[model samples]
Target: MKMKNIRYLSGTGVAILVISVFSVACKVISPDTGELALKDAYKNKFYIGTALNERQIMGHDAAAIQVVKENFNAVVAENCMKSGMLQPVEGEFRFELADRFVEFGEQNNMHINGHTLIWHSQAPRWFFKDDQGNDVSREVLVQRMKDHIYTVVGRYKGRIHTWDVVNEAILDDGSWRKSKFYEIIGEDFVKLAFQFAHEADPGAKLMYNDFSMALPGKRKGVVAMVKKLQQQGVQIDGIGMQGHIGLQYPAIDEFEKSILAYSDLGVKVMITELDLSVLPSPWENTGADVSANFEYQQKMNPYAAGLPDSVDNVFQERYLDFFKLFLKHQEKIDRVTLWGVNDGQSWKNNWPIKGRTDYTLLFDRENRAKPVVKSIIQAAQQPHSDEKKKRKQSI
Candidate 1:
């Protein structure tokens, strides 16, 4: 149970860097249960999960799959459940990958989360177009939305515990993104999507997920939108703040405000798609828009060789800070899911700035637990605020 000073080697027998940024011999084992797993360490606090890539789900990457089984209690499909992936050509459905993903979670006794029911990006071209390639009428789009949701949600009604029913519909400035969904159907699209999803699976938890959540404009916009959904009696269960963060931006306090704000809406606050990048960003501000792309720059890809010890210290501390915040508000938070299982398969590598080697996950490419994992486990062992107050009163 005690995993200390463990040095890992790649399949090619290259020695992976030792995770020595923490104490000389860090321990990831739970103090009480002695289980060295994220799911076990935070079992009482909240669900700790990771997004599984197709490779991991299809049994291609045995090492990553083992890491997931050992650490996470919940799994969300990385790409398979997206609208385009599921229903590429109108009525044609592709459930092979998605079916395997859900089955993997079920076999492992993990919470199965549907990545997305609807989104502007990765939606099939046919979704917003007519047979002649013109933009479909609002009425037609609405019907299409309902059909897609009902079919996808209904397919895994009782199995998928949560669905990101709508994603990134609003921009950082508290305005609608003018996406095909918004352009054709207006803001009613979100409401209708939620309604359709609820009709499909009344039991599954529905969420509105977006990025750049720490921005004041974005926070207010989501608060208002969710409030409207509540007023209209829509079945929205949670808000997923995509934690696609960097080392310095999104000050912890600013991020905390968004968490408290969303929690005030009386819905579960989930830190979904959580990943912290150690590399420098090219943009002054960046949100998780799949369309945004920048030319590959060597300057941006500085850490190609490896993340230095100095950067690792800062990275570890930042993760600890965020996890501590989640622990502080564990009552309002439902789950914290990493976007990918490990650095090797992370989407961050090709996002925004393409071909950048970013160390943006807890496990390294070699499937070794970084030193920060130990610190996080230890932090979870600390008593909650209420517990501490009671102990002080007793003293």
Candidate 2:
């Protein structure tokens, strides 16, 4: 790609713009600390995956998936099989797309994590209602939850390594969010959700994921919630941290505290939605974004500062710093997932930034891993296979 002239905040003294891909003129954003070379450290220890479109998955030859599978042990379908996305209308399940996705992982012997079983958003509205133009009865809701989990999880069985069994079920305060499950099933919906998932696929790991649990208030709430569930014999296997940091929030120390707290619960933890946005603020008001959902946000601005080569260096550096902490506690850290394939697809480019573009993913549009990607891969390393496949390709 040719360098394009770049400009931002035009002339604001505090304004900072680094050398974006398109910019020809160099702007001193932050001093470069040279390449972090993270891929080496992370090699063999983990897998990085993206939810690709049908084309990106099926269009690739074995080499594509092999390329990715060799680097990590797991791959996840972005949205092919989510409840709402798959079974938008009752009894009309669309399994073709997801079917192909799993095929790739199975062929490569990669650990596949079903993106989710339940989420308030992206679900077909029908689940919350019924045939008589009334809300579904509690029994109906429970059955639906059971049926969905049983079918999906049962179908995959030993093939799927983990199911985000109950996603974002807890509100930021750590109380259960009143999703379709809550509205129809009343309460204790979280327990039932996990219970059903366990029964469906006893072999697969089960997890509850949410953002904001990395703060003191919510983190404490999550800890309390997990303890209660464990006491009842609920099979909660993991907690997804949904690492969506932004321009000045959460104070790194606070985020670390959240990790330690969860680790103490003896439940495995992961930075599920790991994306850092250099987007603007008032992000507090953004809607339906992958990073800043209507449901969660980091309290303090997480993304603090301009993009100097040094700060840009720190931006990438900070990512590894957290990873190092993650490695320090690897016994409890299970996985780290980047929300999208590359910067282009990140919801951040448009969300809180509104119309302005944001560069925040580990890979650029060309499919080459970026500095951040290398750092993550290098922070830790383990053993992997010889499989080689491109994780993302044109469908």
Q: TM-score winner among the candidates?
A: 1
RMSD of each: 7.6, 13.7
Candidate whose lDDT is highest: 1
Model 1 quality (TM-score): 0.91
Candidate 1 regions exceeding 4 Å error are 1-35, 390-395
Per-residue lDDT, model 1, residue 114, is 96
Model 1: worst 10 consecutive residues (lDDT sum):
14-23
Q: What would the per-residue lDDT of candidate 2 be over residues 1-395, giving only the tens digit for each residue?
A: 22333332455422344345323353211122133233224433444444455555675544334335434456777778789877888878888888888888888676688978877778788887877778888888888877887888887888888888777766666666766677777657788888988988888888888876666767877888889899999999888888777646557788888888888888888778777766445736412234453323443234333245755675677666777766665556778777766666676655653444556776655555667655555445432221112223322
Model 1, span 312-373: residue lDDT tens: 99999999999999998998999999999889889989988888899999999988888889
**Distance from true position, residue 14, model 1, in Å?**
36
State each candidate's clash count.
0, 47
Ten contiguous residues minimizing lDDT sum, candidate 2: 382-391
- The deviation in Å at residue 80 for candidate 2 is 1.3
Count of clashing pairs, candidate 1 = 0
